[model samples]
Target: MLSIENSKKRVTIHDVAAAAGVSISTASKALNNTGRVGIETRERVKRVSVEIGFRPNALARGLLSKRSFTIGLLTNDTYGRFTLPLMAGVAEALVDHGVSVFLCAIEDDPAMGQIHVEAMLDKQVDGIIATGKRIDRSLPVDLSNLPVPVVYAFTEGRADSVSFRSDDGQGAKLAVEWLSRIGRRRIVHLTGPEAFFSVRERAAAYSAATAHKEPVLYGVWSESWGHEAVARIWSAPGEKPDALFCGNDQIARGAVDALREHGIKVPEEVSVVGFDNWEIVAAQTRPPLTTVDMELKELGRQAGLTVLALAEGRPVEPGVRKLPCRLVVRQSCGGQPSEK
Candidate 1:
């Protein structure tokens, strides 16, 4: 037996065949389940191949199967906070299909995006999944005329392209309705920049749910903005909001800290709900945050499956698909105590 580690030798089909005590042709047929071969013999060959650490060459398999079995993921999110989860989802969704993904971070540079796209095209990727930091924004390159199928995930797409994104309105409604059910009437909406598409969508949902008693507070998507928003709302000293619905977790965390500084008990004095159930930020809060989860990973999985379907010539309905979001219950909303 070849000592694969000591000899630094690549295990081949020939080695597998020899280990299985069969001819190369017979071994190939048995391993591939092609031609005529006894089931017992096929199982033996497979077991021997595994034992000998035989790995078939992907390029050779592609040549025979007429597919590279590779896909490209284009993104401008260098930080990878959003990209990593989406990529993991895509990988999980395509695991059964035996497909691999190539991630390209263009960093919002048009030239860089084109270079990555061309490189992937040269490698003959089966399809491309274009994603970005913002759902309303497009990647820096053009995928309109690629030879392969392209799907948009959390990124803007051309008119006819199939795209998947979070349902911002539904997620906001879940948070607002939950607060309302818990008897929170004086609700205030604090969110990010008004120019952002998601902010508008969420604000609209909050207003509709609350009947627009107080105006929506639009500011930066940051902890500082959240801190300042609380100050501004309390400065007038009218009827204080009993509940605050923030656009994202960062803002909610800031609000919680500010409330504590002002001697207010969370959920006891003022309930808070945030969007984007980012565990890193949400779980670290004092009482933890009750936030709406956009289910980004699920969005990526659906995008991956849709792209693969397009690549395989399967009929996939074109147009934007908004996936549903769910509420993640935590202590911030005066819910039951969580298990430690």
Candidate 2:
């Protein structure tokens, strides 16, 4: 065991070797059961190593093994703002498995994602994790054609490659269900701009959420657009919608602002819902906004795991690896039952 008083004298394979009365090579071979070492000696060395605090140096092992142990992160974000924590979860999951990481942010252009994907082919990345909406499925997906696995985060891969994505339909369903649970039958949906895949799916899901009902849906991607949509809804209705659903939290935030400005009370008079949990910004609202938790971190983690598999000449998973969305109840939505 490590001595509590001697923090400087950290345990090493050499210390285990000395205690076991064996050369470093013997200790290494014994620990890894490599280089034709005897089983009994290996067992004794392992036992002694376990007796103290000894850990194999993963970097050294990775170096010797010629496995770059690095996964390339491809994205078009100008800066790795949201991508950072998401990548953190994926990296933590990979590093424990002795995988290293390489990250590159492409310019905000769709072409940049394509260019980066080609660039990664020349680099020593074992796999790729493409993030953000700007990533063109057509560009980096050719890597899927290679022996190295490729994965995508918060983005979609081309049809030519196996891709993993959150089940946006499920997320949409969850948002609607939560609103339904709180007596928000007369709901309104405000979405982001129509260019992105998520925007389209979320729109479909939102519209579907109001099937057989008179609920209204306004498709727009920005807060300004959300404000406009809300304004339009109020102009028509005497009182306005009982609930609101947004494509993303940004739009939801704007919707809430517009509703409050119009002398409408959220949840009590009108309930609001949004996708993408985004707790940092959502919680700070005067009345914390009730939103759906898309679990982006877990989505990134799964994307990474699938990509690792593809890099190994293995079959990549087909179909949506649908992630679940949670209803984050806050002050913005009413907990009471509805009349209509």
Candidate 3:
């Protein structure tokens, strides 16, 4: 039971122990959810602590535990397109455990990357999560043998390191299969350069889904390419494709605009689906774009947890973790309604 203590004074573990009629060590174990304490005693101790407004000092706890309870996020993605959502996920996963995340954007500068890495190490960060704009590329500075645990998210990682990335093939298959379910045939793939690893993976999936009936149109990841590709397809001597699957939301927006200009009714005539469900492009399109969401936030959540586990001296398997994708339905695909 909670005793009548001075409300103005800072309540420490001793106060909680006295209020709950338990020893200091038992109170500590109960509060931290460690050691073998009876359920009733643990509950009583926690209840008394809350009732007495007891708050643990984070600095003192860290010093005693020999852990900073902080993580560093190192990224080259200055645009924050992917990093923002991923950071949100990491923060969400770690906040409950009193963990703070420090974000450092190195922007492809090796010197700056090294400087930021050194600063994080100086601050005694428990772990680091390396992320980037693309999955096939690594950050400029090497993080091979740091003193802390390193986890990779949406970036190239070492062969033995644990990494997390969205499954491009799965995302492509989701888009293609959604179009197929809506009775779209002769689907043409308008995507970015074939040199990109993601482009190749998506193209392979598209080919397998479509049975190689149509060739993929590879170009830059731009709206102009999408527009020009549409013009070229419409001007061809063969039958027009009933649907178009773009590599990204920007391309999908361009395709939709071009179709509108060419007097082709969207969905009614040619359904369109895009990848990377980028809201800026997907949500503002004429009829709104139905795209594949890579679930980067969930990937970040998993990466954060993995790094935390490593920091806590827990075992984790070293390999690439591929998260599945989900299709966001919208008017562009003539779907029932918009669903993310």
Candidate 4:
């Protein structure tokens, strides 16, 4: 039988141990699954704690274990275009373990980044995950010798450290192959600047996938660039490309709009594919884009777990991990709406 007054009071580990007929140390070990304890005794303590609504004090646990059960997420993607989805994944992965995430956006300011890093260190964060707008660039602040473990996601990292990013080459190949599969013989690649590592990688893959038959248009990552590229190609072309594989959804949207203005029908006379299946841009496009998804959320989930493993003293091989990308089909590609 439960007493109303007792239920209203906080159930401490001491009360749990008392109810389970175990010592305080034993109860702690059982609840945390730390020290070796008899299986039956551990089960009994856990059952009793649940029945009594025993919730361990996070601060007390952190003090005793020298672990804050918190992670710091540092990013320069102030727009939140990439950071927000990745943050959600990190939070989802850590929430089950009673871990919290602290987010800091520095926006390319070294001083601000250093300040945020110091603050997170002051808070005794268990680990830190550094992310950014581009994978070729590093954060403004130095994170090389931090006391806490560091994991890099969607950003450049030290050669000796662990990092995660999408396989841009594979993603580009997927896009090109899809265009070829739908009987589109001539496919043009409209992408961002050649200086960008991702742009170069995707361009190489696009060339190989198309047998070096199509032109690779290097331009800025903007809808205006997409529109201008279309105008240039159509004006001085032998035969207009039957398909356009863009660097991003924005470019794809612009190309679609230009094609529409030129009295061209998408998926009927021309097919368009894009990278970065950003819903805000991809879904809202006139014909909805068939694009490549980098799966940033899954990348974040893996990065979060890797950092947690490091914080827990678990061994993890350090290297750049390139997760695979998938193609999302929509009305623009002359295919049934589906995700691959």
Best by TM-score: 1
CA lDDT, every prediction?
0.91, 0.72, 0.93, 0.92
Cα lDDT tens digits for candidate 3, 180-297 = 9888988999999898899999999999999999999999998998899999999989799999999999899899999999999998899999988899999999989999999999
In angstroms, how far off is 34's CA in candidate 3? Answer: 7.5
Please give the lDDT score for candidate 4.
Answer: 0.92
Candidate 4 lDDT by residue in tens digits, 1-340: 9666755777899999999999999999999898999999999999999999998888887887889999999999999999998998999999998789999999778988899999999988999999998999999999988998999999999999999999999999999988888889999999999999999999999999999997799999888888998888888948899999999998998999899988889979889998999999899998899999999999889999999999999999999999999999998989566645
**Runs of candidate 4 exceeding 4 Å displacement:** 1-11, 14-53, 336-339
Model 1 agreement with the true structure over 159-243: per-residue lDDT tens digits: 8989999999999999899888899999999999999999999999889998989799999989999999998888876899999
How close to the true structure is residue 84 of candidate 1, measured as C-alpha lDDT?
88
- TM-score for candidate 2, please give it: 0.78
Candidate 1 ranges with C-alpha deviation above 4 Å? 1-7, 15-25, 38-48, 337-340
Q: Quote the positional error of residue 227 for candidate 3 in Å.
A: 0.9
- How far out, in Å, is residue 10 in model 1? 2.2
Error of 2 at 6 (Å): 25
What's the TM for model 3? Answer: 0.87
**Ranking by lDDT, best first?**
3, 4, 1, 2
- In model 3, which runs have C-alpha deviations exceeding 4 angstroms? 1-55, 338-340
- Comparing 3 with 4 on TM-score, the higher-scoring candidate is 4
